[model samples]
Target chain A: MNFWFAVFRQAGRNLRQTWTSQLMTFLTVSLSVLIFAFFYLIYTNMIGAGDRLSDDLRLIVYLEDDPGPEMQEQLRRKINNFDKTESIQFISKFKAYERFAEQLGEDSDVLTDMPKDFLPASIEVVPLKSLRGYNQIKLFSEYLATLPGSEKVQYGQEWVERFYYFTRLITIVVLLSGALLILTATFMVAYTIRLTIMGRHEELELLKLVGATNNYIRTPFLLEGIIQGFMGSILGLSALYVLFQWISLHFAGPGLLNLFNFTFFPPMVIVSILLGSIGLCTIGSFTSIQKFLKI
Target chain B: MPKLVHNQDPIEPKDIPGNTMIEMIKVSRTYAPDIKALSDISFTVDTGELFFLIGRSGAGKTTLLKLICNMDTPSNGLIEVAGYNIHNLKGKKLAHLRQKIGVAYQDFKLLSDRTVAENIAISMEVSYKKPRAIKQRVRDLLEQLQLTDKHDALTGDLSRGEQQRITLARSVANSPRLILVDEPTGNLDAATTERVMDLLTRCNKAGATIVIATHDSSIYKDGNHRVMELRSGKIHSLSRNNR
Candidate 1:
């Protein structure tokens, strides 16, 4: 339609006429999106590592003393009978001492100086595969503590609870920060586009005098905002991808990177970012048009 | 020639009856506190008539035109144009109302950045006219206004008279029902002024209710059309040629 053509024509003209200011808006949106994406990647990898840790959950129930074989069998039966217990393993005191010696490699003198039964025997309980969440594992640990002949129930103690708490805090912080970044991007785009509109104030008054409706006047601005938003997001995402690749290549080791599973965002997350950028820009332009045009 | 309706006696806007194109009853426009542009002004112009508003600078001629076209709202009273109350019109209704009216401002408010043809086409383009149709319309206006050579010239590059002609061409591109022109000959030579007046007469003959605001004596000396002179913000006198 001619109406749409005019809108495009006007939008294109404005883009060219105010490229300097528009580029500032584009860069601001890009930087904001990049910051948020970086936060997202960090948070996602932390959560992923925490999830892997939870999946490999092992609850070690140290015994009061070396229980007899029959008593060990009874304890195993009692733990397995419980609702969420998947499987259990019994380690003899000698086997525990051997494992401890393996952990203290190059320090065989410490083991020789200690007594023969220095290590305590233990039963390791694996909860139901479905019980990987923090609360579920804690409840299972509490159930294990009730059994007789058990010294202490250690579900990786300090780290598991702390990691779960950290995951929750990171999630909340990332979400709030991402939202604030988006808000800042929206206002920046609005302010930048407002300058562009002010530059064309004379033309706008002429358009109004010649009988342009509010929709007709606003269409071009909306289109401009959408295009700017889409471009900025693409730039941000591209920058993020390059940075991730650089870090991955530079730190090509088997320690933290492999443990935390750090990588570029998934395709689905990228798509969401693109869509969100467009929406933010559109909202910014709409705000500017509503305030400046006032029609 | 278009009909020039002469008022034999004083007639208020509220008292004017039958097929009126514009009616303003006690319209007052005040800016801020105690600065009044127009006070209790009332007038009526019938359809298909050529009328002139004679006044000095800052005599509220431009403000009155703005009020009739709904570009600016009247502070106090009623303005009815094309059978719709101007105060109640908004959005689509206001736009539609404005579409039927054309204004050539005293300062010739042409988009200087655009070409002369573009300036003319914009008037028709806003109404969603086809590109081909707009091109033809612009061409015809260019020829009619004797600005065919300046069609591609930037409006800002042209002389004031040329810019005024482009403004006129743009204003009448839609063949509006009402044409409100303010000081159309402000920057024209005597020869150009006659040509401009002739072009307006041609549009008036095509059935546009024309209102011209001018301090030029040549336009009102003949007293052919009804002339209303504003001395401050009130109508100083209203008269027409007796012949």
Candidate 2:
């Protein structure tokens, strides 16, 4: 038989003989990976929400009362020339009054009582996508405040920036915790494998004595680790997907899905899962074999 | 009339003809700073020779065997097996060297999870033998050892003697040039010991050098084979029969 085929067959036999131990390993791997996936999902959703909030924000530069047409055109030109400005829309006083009237349909008298002089014309500046972040929008708005005949600059960027900062902090914390958890899980799994190998040290020694090379002796254990890691990742990912779908279906509130309309995992998640499983198994195998298969 | 021979404890050294297959020159094995297991010992095993190393416990017989297999290194000496200096071999070449040598442990190092066939197949598998060839070889070994009926039995489920035989079968399955047996008869009954020794004799006749380390000398009468008696970390004498 091929060398690897023998390794695999031996690994299969080992797994069959120690099904309980293998099952325990599988559960440990699956739970750890599942926790990681859940945390990653949360982190991804928070980032997506922050991005959407920034995208929808616009900078409003309120106009001075009775500004002349030349000044208006000058301001419009100035707004257009700004590097951060993507598009500018001029809201005339009449259109503002009409919008007010529309909003107060049942209370039209309140809109009629407000004098025409009380309304202020404004220019809405939509910034480029790169300038849509909290700090970037704040800097842009502060610069716009110094413009001539500008009554005030109003944008929800400050609150959004605060939310972004808080959520970004949360994402960092969650990501760090996830990383630590993954390391812990890997170490634990490796130790378990090592102990299991120790229990069968005589068998391993026999194999070495019978002319089994390091690779041939280690292949089965490595495959076992990989199988456990794969099973864990799949279980974790399936659980996360189910949880995400269930939350999306039942809990339509201001949490992750509703606030961000968070996108589901693309093909990349599957690739990541494969890579993660293989990487963990490789590390576990390398470590276990380093000590067990020596001489 | 039947021949009458003296039952000496160890035969005289002049009777042994040297055709060395394994040689160790001034070998000293010291673990850590002060633990000296074997010190300045030299010996040789001839081709197709059946030799016994007799000593009490902690006499370094196991360590000697391990050194021959290159599993452990000696503190100082030149150790050669099958005409290669063992310390220089590494990686696949070391594996190749090990393939030429077979070792049996007193613990009966059979893979408990595997069947008798699989346990025996490991030897051929490492040598990269073809599947059909491995199957045929395993079948032939099973028949030779009278273990054909237990081919599918788990190694752990077999009796002590059967397990030891399986270990022996695995050791000789690759038809190694040299076999290092550590306490081969330590755990076997009298009948089983005789049977195992008979098998070893057969293997020696087939041209494989056999070196057995044990404390049991009741069954091994003097003048039957060469005997090396070790005492206090040194070879007290090396003798053989004048057959």
Q: Which candidate has the highest lDDT of all? A: 1
Candidate 2 chain A: worst-modelled 10 consecutive residues by lDDT = A180-189
Candidate 2 runs further than 4 Å off: A49-55, A73-83, A102-110, A157-159, A251-259, B1-20, B30-37, B46-60, B111-121, B128-163, B183-194, B214-231
Best by TM-score: 1
lDDT value, candidate 2, whole model: 0.76
Q: How accurate locally is residue A246 in candidate 1, as Cα lDDT from 0 to 100? A: 95
The residue ranges of model 1 lying beyond 4 angstroms of the native Cα positions read A66-83, A92-119, A129-148, A158-169, B1-18, B220-224
Error of 1 at B94 (Å): 0.9
lDDT of each: 0.82, 0.76
Candidate 2's iRMSD: 12.3
Q: How many clashes (backbone N, Cα, C below 3 Å) per candidate?
A: 0, 1
Docking class of 1: acceptable
Kindly report which residue pairs in candidate 2 clash with one another: A30-A232
How would the docking of model 2 be graded?
Answer: acceptable
Q: Summarize candidate 2's per-residue lDDT along B42-148 as a digit string, tens digits.
A: 98877778888888888888888888888789999998775668778765557666776878777777878779998888887877778998889888877777789
Model 2 interface DockQ: 0.32
